[model samples]
Target: MTTPTTPPTAGGGRSEYLHGLDVLRVVASAAIVYTHLASWISGKNRSWPIGDLVNAVTSPLHLRPDLAFIGVASFLLVSGLVVTRVSLRESPGEFLRRRAVRVLPPLWAALILAFAVVSTGLVREMAPESAATALHLLNNAWFGPYFVGGAVLLPVVWTLLVQLAFYAFTALTIPLLRRWPWLPSAVAAALISVTTSLVPQGAVGPVRTVVAFLPIVFIGQLISLAQAGRVRLGAAVALGAVHLLLFVRADLVSRGIFTPGGGYHNVLLMIVLLVLLFMSANGPVARSRWTRALARRTYSVYLVHMPIGFAVLELLVDAIGASWALLISVLVIAVATELFYRAVERPLERLLRRRRRRRADLERPVDTDEPTPGGNRDGLAGRGADAGRSARQGADIA
Candidate 1:
C-alpha cells in the first residue's frame, strides 16, 4: 500500500517497524490482482471458459466480485498513516515534493507502457480508438480524463488521483494538524457529510468520490497521531469512530445500496477487518524474506497489474487453456512489476533520498570558527551539532 516509512516507536523509547503492514500490502496486492484477473474479468465475459470456471468455483462460496476493492481501501489507509508520519517532520513544500517524486514518475511510465500495449491490440477488451490519440494518452497521463470526460488510460489510476488530492489536503492543513491534531479530519468529515447529503441521489461524481475518500485517509492519520502521542488515545479513537461513520454515510448517500449482498456491507466489514489486522498483525509476519520481497514491489505491482496483466491474459487465453493462460498472465505480471520497480520506482526513490540528504545538509548550521579539541567553539556549535542530529534523524524516518 505504502512504501515502508519509519514507524512510530513503542513505549520505553524503543523503535519498532510495523512489518505487519508490509505483509498486509503484499496480501492486498495479491487480492486485487486475483480479483481483477479471476473475479472481475470473468464476471464481465460470461462466454469465456475462465469466466465459467471462476463463477463455478466462487459462486458456491458467495464471494462478491468487487470484494477485492478492499485492497484499495487498505492502500488508502496505509498512505494516510505513513504519509502523515513523515509529514510531522517535513515542511509542507518538502512533503509535497517528496510525495510527487515517489508517486508520479512510475505512474507516468506505466501509462506510457499501457498505451503502447493497448496500441498493439493485445488487450481485446479495450478499443484501440480509446487510446489511439496522443491527446487522449496525455489526458490520462495527467489525470485529466476524470475531469475532462475522457476514458482513463489506466483505470486504477483514479485511486492515485484521490491519493494526490489527499496529499494536497495534508500539506495545506499541516499547521492545523500540528496544533489541534484532530480538527482537520473533523472538518473534512463534516464537509463531506453535508456535501453528500445535499447532492441529488445517484449523482455521485469525481468531487464526491475525492471528498468521500478523504475521511478514510483521515482515519489512518488519527491512528498515526495517536501512536505518536500527538493526540490522546481515547480522543483519537473517538474521532476515528466518528470519521468512519461519516465515511459510511457518504458511501451510502452517493452509491446507495450496492448489491446482491446488502449494500456495501462488505465494505464496512473489510475496513473493520483491516483495522483489526493493523492492530494485531503489525509485527513479525513481515520478517519473512518472501514477504518482504513481495511487499517491496507491491506498489509497482499495483501500478501495472491491471493494464499489463489483463492484456497478457487476453492475448494468451485463446491460444492456451484458461488455467495456463491465467498462470502465465500472473507470471507476466510478476516480471513486469519487478522490471517497473527496478527501472522506475527504485530510481525515483533514490533521487528522493538524495534530495532529502541534500536538504538536510543545507539546513545544518556550519561552524566557521575552529572548535577546541573535542569541544564546541560556542553554543552555536552545540546547536549546530543538535540540528545536524535532528536533521539526520528526520531523514532516516522520512
Candidate 2:
C-alpha cells in the first residue's frame, strides 16, 4: 500500500505525517509475503522441508493459509483512505492522472518482466504452452484474465483491477463527495446490498467480486473523511457499519467465486484488528527509519514477490535443497523488489511529478508589474505558497 506524504489538517493545512500507516504497511506486506511463501506455497508443494515445518506449526493452531488474505484487506483499506485523501484535494482529471501514473507503469513493467521470466523456462510449471502467446500477456496486461476466463500470470494483480475500479468510482463522484462526504458511500452500500440480494447466484461473477470488495474500500474512505473532520465521527461509524454488513453479505453470496479462505467473519475480524492497529500505533517506533523504508517498498514487493520467488524456488530447490532454496528465493525477491522500486516505480513517480509541475507552471498567468487596486502581491504570493504546500501533501497520498 502507498503511504500518504502528509494528511491535510481539519483546517485545510498540513497535518503530521501518519507514521503509523508505515508500520501497518510493513506488517501487511510481511503477512502477505509470508502467507504466500510459507503457508500457501508450502501447502501446495508438500515435499518442501519448509512446507512440512510450516504445516506442523500452523496445523495445530487451526490457521488456514488463505486467511492470509487479511493482508489484502489491509491494503484495500489503506488504498481507499489514501485515494480519498488525494481525490479531496485534486480535480477529477488530476486525480485520475495521478492514480494512473502511480499504479499503471509498475504493473505493466511487472507483467512484462513476469512474461519474460516464464518464457525463460526457469519455472516449468508456470510456463504453460499458452504462456508464450502475446495474447496471454495482453490479457493479463489489461486484467482480462480477471474479467474473462483466462489464466493470470500474476495472481495478485486481481486486486489492482479492483483498485482501478474504485479509482474510477471516486473520480466520478468527487463533486458529490466534496459536498457531502457520507452520501456517496451510503448510496453505494445500499446499491450493492440491493444488487447482491436481487442478482441470481453466480450470474454476475466478476461484477459480484468488484461490488463485494467495494464496501471495504468505502470503509477506508469513510475513515479518511472522519479523520479530516469532513464527516462526523458518529456518521462515519454508522456508514462504516453499513458498508461492513454489505461487504459480508456480498462476499457470502459469492462465496465460491474466491479461493475458500477463512470465511467472511474471519476476514471481518482481521479488518477490525488492522483498523485497531492503525488507530493505536503512532509512536516513535512507527516513525523509525527502517519502518518508513520498508513502507516505501511494500508496493514493489507485493508486485514482484510471488512470480519471481516461485521461479527462484522452483529453479533452486533441487540443487540447493529446500531450506537453502527458500532462503535464496527470499533474497532474490528482496533484491528484485528493491531494484524494481529504484528502477521503475520511483523514477516514473518523479517523472510524473516533474511533468505535473511543468504543466502547472505553463498554466499559470504571467507576472505583471502593475498592482491591483486592493489586492497585495505579497498576500497573493503567500496564498500561492499555501496552495503549493497543500498540493505537496496531496501528492504524498497518491
Candidate 3:
C-alpha cells in the first residue's frame, strides 16, 4: 500500500504530519464509547440481575446527552478537511474508487460480524431478517429505517452513509471547486445553515441529520482551503462564525452530553478543537509508533466498538458486576476490533486495491517497446508517473 503524505504547511517546506488529528480521533472514540455505555447502562426495561447496581453506579449519567453525536460531527469535520486535501490530487473516478475500497470493505466486515451477533438473538431489541437485513445494510441507501419495520441493528452506521454521501458530493464538485473554492463552499455552508435552522431540533431524523451536519463538513473544507492559502483567513473565519451561529441557533449544540451549562461548553470545545487544527496546520507534531498504530486502527474501532461493547456489557454485566463488566467490555471490544483491523479490514482493503490496479492496467493501451533514453524514456519519467499515482493512492487512504 502507498504511504500517506502530509499536507504542506503554508510556509512551503514539507509540513509535519498532523499528530493532533489522531489525538482528536482518540478523544472522539472515547466520547462515543462514553455516550453508548451511558445508553446501555440506562436503557429501559432493565431486568438483568445486576440492573439495580448498574443503574446505581451509572444512573448519574442517565441524562440522554448525545456526546456521541458531537463526536460524529467532529469526525466529519476532520474527514472533510482531509478529503478536500486529498481530492486535489485525484481524478473524480480515482477518488471515488479509492474511497469505496478504503471504507466499504472494512465496514462490510463489521456488518457481517454485527449480523452474526444479531442472528444469535443476542440483540433481542432489534433482530433483523437475516437475508434482507444484510442486503439493505450493505446497500446503505441514505434513507433511514435500514431494515424492515424500521429496526436498525447498528444505528451508528447512519453516519457512514452520510459520509458516503459527502464523498460523492465532494467528488462531483471538485472540478468546479478548483476555480472558486471559497465562494462555493461559503454558499454551500450558508445553505446548510439555513436548512438546519428550518428543521426542528428533536425532529432531525436521518435525512435531516445529514443535512445539518453538512455545514460542519463544509467548515472543515473551508478551514483546509484557508490553511493552504487558497482562501482568505478572514473570509473563512466569517463563514465559520455564521455556520456555528446557525448550528447553535438550531439548538443542535445542546443535544450532546459534552454540552454542559446550556451548550457553552460544547461551543467552547468546538472552538478549542478548531484552534488546535489551525495550530497543528503549520507545526511539527510529536509522533510515535504507538500513536501511528492506533491512528491506523481508528476507523475500525469506530465501526465495531459500539455494538460489540454493548454486547459484551449485556453478556457479562449480571455475572461479573457492573464495574467489572464495563471494564471488561471496553478491553475485550477494543482488542477484538484491533484484531478485526489486522485480519479482515487491512487484508480486504489491500485485495480490493490490487484488483482495482489490475483492472486499470488491463484497460490501458499496450506499449510495444520502451522509449529511447534521450526521449524521456522509462527510468525517471516512468518513476515520476508511478510516484504521482502512488501519491494519489496514499492521499485517498489518508
Candidate 4:
C-alpha cells in the first residue's frame, strides 16, 4: 500500500515521480483475479479448455496453473517499491499509521462479508463449525491462523498476513533504511535470510514461512532503491539475483518451503515478473485519471474478490454454465469493488486522514513564547536585521 507524495530526491536534488504505478496496480489485481478464476474453473473440470488455456499461459515454466502466484509476487514487489518510497518521506509512525488506514478498514469489511457468505451457504469452502469459532473471524483480522488454528474465512488472507508482517518489519527498520539506503541493510538481511533457512524446521513451521518470504520482500525494497537512484542499478540487480538464487536454494534445501505446485520454475517466473514490472513502471505507460480511479479500488478488489467471486460463481454456474458464470462473477466483483471503494473504503480513508491530520496538528510543538538571543521572537538565528535597523536609526539621528 503506497500513498503518492512529493518526495525529495537523493542528495536534495529535483523530484522524481513514478507514473504508471497505478497501471501496475490494476494489472496486479487483474492477474490475481485471473489466477483465482482459473483455479475455480480447473477445479470444476480439469479437462476444460479455458482452464487448460489459463494453465498454459500462466505457467509457462512449471506447466502448473498454480504458477499464478506470480500475481501475488508482483503485488509484493510493487508494494515494496511504493512502501520504500513512502518510508523515505515519512516517519516510521506515520508510515505504519497510513499503512493501517489504507489496508485495514476495507479488509475488515471483506472479512465480515466473507463470514456472511459462508454462514448463508453461499460458499462451502469452510464448514459451519469452522465459521462458528467466531474468534477465527476476529483472528483473520491479523492473519493469525497459525495462532488461531486453521479457520480462515478467505484463503487469500494469507497474502495479507505476509503483507502486514512486511509492513511491520519495514516500519521498524525504516530509519535504518533511510540512513544506509539499501546496500548495507540488504547485505545484512540477506545473510540473516540464508542463516534462517539453514535452521532445521520442525515445530516452528510458521517461523520458517516468514523467513522464506523475507528475501523476496527485500528484493522488492532493492528494486525501490534502484528506481529511486539511491542504489546503483547494476548493484541492485546483482544483489537481487543473489537473493533470488538464495530463495530458490533455500526452498530446495529446506523441506518446509512452500512452493504450491511449481518449484524452481515458479521462482523463475516471479523474477521475470518483477523485471517486467520494473520496466513497465519506468516506461511511458503514463498516469491516467481512469487508471487512477480504478486503481483506487484495487485493494477492495483484492480483499473481496476471491471469496465473493467464488460465491457468485457457485451460485450462477449451474444456471448459466461455468463460462458465463465466470464472466458474471467478474462483473459482479467489479461492481462490488466500486461500491466498496465508494461507500466504505474512500470514506473511511478520508475520515482517518482527517483525524490523523488533526492529531498531527495538535501534537506539533508550537513556537515557544521565549525570545532568541538579541530579541527575536522565535528561536532562530538573527539574520542581521536588528543590527541593520540600529545602523539606519543611528544614521537618521546623525
TM-scores, in order shown?
A: 0.81, 0.83, 0.73, 0.79
List, residue by residue over 157-188, the lDDT tens digit for candidate 2.
87777788889989999998989888888888
Worst 10 residues of 4 by lDDT: 389-398
Using lDDT as the measure, which candidate wins? 2
Model 2, runs deviating above 4 Å: 1-14, 44-63, 122-129, 261-264, 359-398
Off by over 4 Å in 4: 1-15, 57-63, 126-129, 183-188, 191-195, 202-205, 263-285, 355-398
| Span of ten consecutive residues with least summed lDDT in model 3 | 374-383
lDDT of 1 by residue, 1-398 (tens): 22323333222111234556666777778877877787535644535565566557756545565345567777777667656766665679977887787777788898888888777777645435457578888887778877767766777787887788888888998888878877877777777778767767666346767766767778778876776567787888888888778766766666642333542445645664565466445445656778767876887898888878878777777777557878888999999999998998778767765776676566555865454332233211122433333232222222
Each model's lDDT comes to 0.67, 0.71, 0.60, 0.63
Which of the numbered candidates is closest to the native, going by highest TM-score? 2
Q: Which pairs in model 3 have colliding backbones? A: none
Shift of residue 122 alpha carbon in model 4, Å = 3.0
**RMSD in Å for all candidates:** 6.2, 5.0, 7.1, 11.1
Residues 1-398, model 4: lDDT tens digits:
12323333333211234445566667778978987876776777634567666666755466446446666676666666666655665567867877787777778888888887777776665335357457778877777676546567877766666567777877788777767776544654666575665677554435566655656666777876776567776787887777676667657666645645555446445554655454445343545567656666777888778777888887988888877888899999998888877887878666754764576456545765444344233211121443222222111111
Error of 1 at 153 (Å): 1.0
Give per-candidate clash totals: 0, 1, 0, 0
The Cα error of candidate 4 at residue 308, in Å, is 1.1
